[model samples]
Target: MKATQELHNLGQSLWLDNITRGLLTDGTLARYINELVVTGLTSNPTIFDQAIRTTAFYDDDIRKKTAAGKSTEDIFFELAIDDLTKAAELFRPDYDATGGVDGVVSLEVSPLLADDADGTIHAAEKLHAQANCPNLLIKIPGTAAGVPAIEETIFAGVPVNVTLLFSCEQYLAAAEAYLRGIERRINAGLDPHINSVASLFVSRWDHAIGDKVPAELRNRLGIAVAQRTYKAYCELYDSPRWSKLAAAGARPQRLLWASTGTKDPNAPDTLYVQALAAADTINTIPEKTLLAFADHGKVSSTLPADGGDAEKVLAAFRAAGIDDQALAAQLQLEGAESFNKSWHALMQCIVEKGQSKSTGTQAEQL
Candidate 1:
């Protein structure tokens, strides 16, 4: 059996960290769903930017929207929603079979709103309404501003994928935001089963400390961080607070391992995927990583819920002068900035594409 199937059977979800119109039109996404066990997908400004800039699939739509006097951002959203809605439909079977637990496709809110809580909340709501797919998750960063937005969005009955979290503490913050939202729903006599996921980035932790840490610690920090976070996740759900909510039909916001693609060339391609495997969690992996894992990956054991050796590994890093809390803050800030940069670049790409199309038409007429 393919390792992907094995992982799925082991109770971990495999979500593609990509979305492109070609994948949907060519049935590639569906093929992955059937053969590789990819239950869902996730997208961001970077992914969309790459998709729009590199492919001609969206050009006709871009030209149409440009002619309709749509703003760059508006045109981009129109294209994104169109693509994501289609992908959501393709995954609808898994979604239904799993009772809204597995199949999900995520679209992030404007990174420019990373620091604007109200704007983020509004954008999430608008996008969710516009997409109108129950399997779609509007992604919000786990930034301080975004935490409140997450709560408000969830309380308003929109599912969320809390992104950009780095450390266990950051994961906890996002989890708390989700729980608060669910608690508010219960208080208001609303259904507490709103879906959510707190995405903790994995590979970036190792990438950030790669050069700083010793050779033995290379490519190990991220998995250790996940281990620590997973323990916390299991503990939180086991608590009476979560138990009470669960009794009331509240679903635990799952712990998702994001950025699972190995960044270090010397590291094994399946390093993060193999190390972070656990039941009741999601791992959104890059296409390359997914293929690589399907080719040669092996899942020997699932991650220990009690966080085996996580403390010891973390202690070794601390002894090596890695400040966990400070670095987590830095990584989250850097991640938001990176996405903001991609968002601007994407808008610019749209503007240029629209202009080039108009120019081509004028030349043809001449």
Candidate 2:
């Protein structure tokens, strides 16, 4: 059996961390669904930027939307929504089978809203409504500003993929925000079964620390962080408060492992995928990593519910002079900034492409 299938059977969802028009138009996404156990997908500004800049698949639509005089941001979202909704349909079977637990595709609100809570909330609602797909999730960063937006968006009944979370502390904050939103729904006599996922980014931790720690410590910080966060996740799942909410028909806002792609060339390609295998959690992986894992990965023991030496590992890093809290803060800030940069570049690419199309048309007329 494919290791991907084994991982899926182990109960960790395998979501492709990519979506391109070519993938959809050529049935590649569907093939992954039918053959590779990829039940869901996630996208961001970087992915879209790469897709638009590198492929001609979106050229005609870009020209059409540009000709319509839509703003760059508007054109981008329209294209993103169109692609995501189609991918959502392709996964609809898994979505229905799992009762909305898996098989969802995520579309993020403007990364520029990373600091603007009100704007994030509004855009999240508008984007979710615009997509009009039940399985589509609006991603909001788990930054300090984004936490309140997450609460507000969730309470408004928009399913959210809370992104950019780093430490266990950050994960808890996002989880609490999700909890507050569900609690408000119950208070308002609304259905408490609103779905959400708190996405904790991995891999970037190791990349950031880079040779600062010893070789034994290299490529290990991210999984250690995830283990610590997973322990917290287990605790939250067993919490009496969450049980009460569950009884009220609220779904547990699942813990998702994002950025699972290995960043260190010396590290095993399947390092993140194989090590982070825990049931009931989601691991969104890059396409290359997914293919690598499916070909040669092996799933061993799953993450221990009690965290499996996570604290010990963290302490070792602390001894190595790594400040956990400070690094987490830095990573969160950098991640937001990275996305903001990608968003701007994506918009600029759209503007240039749109203008080039117009220029070519006028030249032909001449």
Cα RMSDs, all models: 2.6, 2.7
lDDT of 1 by residue, 1-366 (tens): 999999999999999999999899989999999999999999999999999998788877788889889999999998999999999998999999989997889999999999999999999999999988999999999999999999999999999999999999989988999999999999999999899999999999888887898888888888889999999999999999999999999998999999999899998999999998899999999999999999999999989999999899899999999998899999999999999999999999999888765444432433
Q: What would the per-residue lDDT of candidate 2 be over residues 1-366, giving only the tens digit for each residue?
A: 999999899899999999889899889999999999999999999999999998777777788889998999999999999999999999999999999999899999999999999999999999988999999999999998999999999999999999999999999999999999999999999998888998999999999999999888998899999999999999998999999999999898989999999988889999999999999999999999999998999998799999998889999999999998999999999999999999999999998888775444432433
Q: Once model 1 is optimally superposed onto the true structure by TM-score, how far is the C-alpha of residue 102 displaced, in angstroms?
A: 1.4
Candidate 1, superposed: residue stretches over 4 Å from native: 358-366
Candidate 1 versus the native: TM-score? 0.97
Per-model CA lDDT versus the true structure: 0.93, 0.93
Query: Over 4 Å off in model 2, which ranges?
Result: 358-366
The alpha-carbon lDDT assigned to residue 90 of candidate 2 equals 96
lDDT of 1: 0.93
TM-score of each: 0.97, 0.97
Clashing pairs in model 2, backbone N/Cα/C closer than 3 A? none
Residue 305 Cα positional deviation in candidate 1, in Å, after optimal superposition: 1.0
Q: Considering only N, C-alpha and C atoms within 3 Å, which residue pairs clash in candidate 1?
A: none
